[model samples]
Target: MEWHNWSGSVSAQPRTIARPRNESELRAAILATPRVRVRGAGHSFMPLCETDGTLIDMSDYDAPIEIAADRASAWVPAGWSLARLTETLWKEGVSLINQGDVNPQSLAGATATGTHGTGKDLGSLSTQVIAFELMLADGSLVVCDAEHHPDLFQAQRLSLGLFGVATRIRINVLPAYYLEERVEARPLGEMAERWQELAAATRHFEFFVFPYADTVIFKSLHPIAGEDEMPHSTDIDERPFRVACELGRKANFLIPPLQRLMMRLSSKPSRRVGPAWQIFPGERTIRFEEMEYELPRADGIPTLLEAIGYIRRKKLPVAFPFEFRLVAGDDIWMSPFNRGVGSSISFHQYARMPWRALFAEIEPVLRGANGRPHWAKRHTLGPDQVHALYPKTGDFLKVRAEVDPAGKFVNADLARLFGIERK
Candidate 1:
């Protein structure tokens, strides 16, 4: 079967591409393949579920979600993209308790990798999952929650779908509400002082600091008191299509130095206010490679500032601001943000630009802060380093061995990184 990824960055000729209409079909498909991997929207940058084996496309099973009246929780298909799910929940007088920057990811894809959004009060998307239905390697159905099969449930939340296929999820929700977003462009020093309060006060807050300049854009989302107004700003330069054009003009065919120069000049700040969905996820059509690490919240600003200093002194032409956001720690054994109050730090560079030099430059800061890289983003930490980052790494590996003893779910990449075959 032909192979293609959602990002189109990585693809291979898979043995087969299976579109299973239901659980039985899915199980049969998995059983047919010597090895299998699940594919959703393919939003991930890293090759989490990539394999030359059979690929399961969960996109065909989209259906209406059933939710409790309190807006507390609901069950949804693993195939549903965040955009459709959030919009549908709003129409039902409810909304997802948390969201990430991109809404194109499938529910299982996002939660499996611990994809998160910024909000001090809110946690990563996986934290809201009260229970999840898994189709094990043996083609057996299992319902995992805090009560039954708790260890499996905890490990499965952000395990990169290593144990089994996630068929459905029961998630926590919130009342459908509007957010009053505020964006400010200010000096970096000022942002450092207000960072803690900013994270604590706003429902969601994130800031981007451009290199070669002190200018930083800070965004905060708060609940609206009265009736919310319609979003008016359509002509913003930061819109996805325009940004894509800008990046194409700068980096597409040009040399790395030229791209750097363009980025240095293009660094600017802007603001917006609107609904939660509108404000939370922006149009990021411009494709750039990203590397993100989750550090303790207490060390967030310091780690960010240290990296900023390194870039400035080294004369690295970083076109974008250092992106920073927070997520409450979860109980997921494999989740990087499971420790508590995780602060995510992301580095962005044009795909054509050489990354080894830049990644080497930033690796020290992450190491010093005891950071853990996001599973779905770019990183080169080996299994030993990954084990050092998560206290429960051994336990998670044990669970994976028990659930998939034959290694039917394993790929070369996962096998090497996780040591699944040996354990």
Candidate 2:
């Protein structure tokens, strides 16, 4: 059977697909195939999980989460989705420090791809990993952390599942808390001027701006002192928005007017108070192809303005809103936020519409601004571009070679990105 990602943008035909029930079975599968790639919740837009050899699905391995007695950390199964993990953590009186808006991604996939949430003080999900157990190509297991196998730890944090398959991960967590969420609409100009201030003041902040519209939907999440009493509302319904997107796709000329109308009709201020986990994730039911780039915090506004100008000038048939968020710096080798505070800008197009041309045209603008593509998002960077942007590219490649010298984990797309030659 053919495997496709959530957005249906990427597909793979693996020679074999294996769902290992335990570590021993997983090790056997790895040793049986010359090439292997792991598929999580199939949330990535890129072809990272595509392979012609063997595809390992970790969902069948449901290991119990082991929380530390001090409530400072937990040993979690890599196969668990963020939604499950966060729910479990909350039950144990703890929660993840930060997490992206969407919660369907598996823990290992999110960490390996450097997935992050919006905040000035919090780094990507990968940064929360205190230790992990990696199964190498040779089926040899090794435990790595900051104090032991330090280099491997740095590389594995955002390893792209290239170094090996992560079976279990120990993550630093915080005591369970409640959050107050506020969503409002504001003029784009106001947001541009106060982005920094807003990010600094809120525990989590992000905004969504539709093309051809002057308004932005601003959202802020802040921790509160009291426990939450209100039931969480998971707004997973996107039928109304999906209808708008379809109209935009079919009419093309209606994009601008439709976007403006939608903004006006749906821009009402809303509030929600709930547990941190409940408030952190947003329901994402609409399918779309996305391309996100992480730029220096200083260049976010200018780059976004340029992108908007380009879209309006070219009249690109895109209707999905552009997403903006902040992420703190980290030291992970392949993390886009490595050593620099970042502002992530995401461009999304309705799944049925044409996006390649639009993405091709705007990529140069982002690249010119020294933006680095998110590992799981769409981008056209080759090894040279990747190496130019990431100073530790060589180090990461060296470590990858040391662990999987035969390049057993590399597929065609990864080979091009990492400049790895398959044996």
Candidate 3:
């Protein structure tokens, strides 16, 4: 069966794709093959799910959400999409601690890959995990938390789909709340100097800047006082942006002007009020290939500006605006933000166009700032760089060896990335 990601950038023709409706079936599917990989919503840009062997499709799995007695957290089904999970949680009067710009990714996929949203003090979804129920390659299920199997739990927080297949995840939650999304135009220079202040002042703050533009779109999501009549929002129509991307794909020369023009047209301030789950993500229809870097808090803006400066000076025609956000640090062994706070910079290009050279040139700027790539995103990091950037690689590899020494969970991409033999 041919399987591809949402953006159609990565494709795989697996020999078998099994949709397991329950844990027993899932185990059977896993044990039936020498090699296996889970297929989430396929939001990852890299070939994390590319497998020539069995591919376990978890979309059919539907375990009940067991809310903790105190309601501070819940045991959520690992395969549920963020869209499904967050909406279901909302019905239960709870919501995820935070979510990224889109919600179609699976709960396990998002947490495993260190996916995150923007907040000065809030860590990524991986940090929200208090425990995990993982099925080992031998089909045995083990539950690990901070107090039980802590080493395994630490590595599982951002396991990158290596340690095992997460069957259930215990994550932190917040009582249902409302958020106000405010987007306005601001000068890049002013923002560069004070973005940290902006981040500290809001519940979530992020900004988008075109490589050649001097202004940025500042978006902040903050809690609203009460649930009242939601204010009307003049959301910028996305159709024009799609058209611009198509134009840029055909004639790269127009990308610079198109971006600046769109920035001008998109300058109008907009406001909307909705549930936290609804407000956290926006509609993302335009497809683009992305490479994201997680840098130290102090280096994020500097790295972004340097890359943008290079883009302008080189007259590189990048289609999408750069997204910059802040994420708090965590202790997850494989997480990019493990040691300290992070500044996340996402570089995107219309997938229809050439990107090898573009990202090739820009990635060094990020790397030079001591930035680490999100495991799921596109990057040229080899095994050496992986070990150098993530000092915990040795520890994680040790855990993987202990749990699945036969390498049942190792796919081609992962085997090469982690220097593990494909068994």
Clashes of 3: 0
Off by over 4 Å in 2: 226-228
Q: Across residues 1-423, which tens digit of lDDT does each residue of candidate 2 receive?
A: 799999998999999999988879999989888989999989999999999889998877857789999989999999888998899889999999999998989999999999999998889999999999878999998999989998889999999999999889999999998889888899999999988888888899999999889999999999896554577887334777888999988899999998898788768898888988888998888888899999998998889999999999988888799999999998888889985898999999888889887789889999999999999999999999888888999999999899999999998999999888889
lDDT of 3: 0.88
Error of 3 at 75 (Å): 0.5
Q: Which candidate order results from sorting by lDDT in descending order?
A: 2, 3, 1
* Arranged by TM-score, best first: 2, 3, 1
TM-score of every candidate relative to the true structure: 0.90, 0.98, 0.97
lDDT of 1: 0.76
- Candidate with top lDDT is 2
**Mind sharing the TM-score for model 2?**
0.98
lDDT of 1 by residue, 1-423 (tens): 566555456666678888888878988988997788888777777777677788888877644578877658998887777887787777877777668777889899998888899877678888889998889999998999999999998888887888898888999987876767666666678888988876778788887765555656677777774365656443135543245435644564332344344344444544445556555666565556678988988898899889888876787644444688888877678888777887888887655555556777888778888888888887887888878877898888889889988888887777878766632
Total colliding residue pairs, candidate 1: 1
lDDT of 3 by residue, 92-117 (tens): 99988888988889999999899999
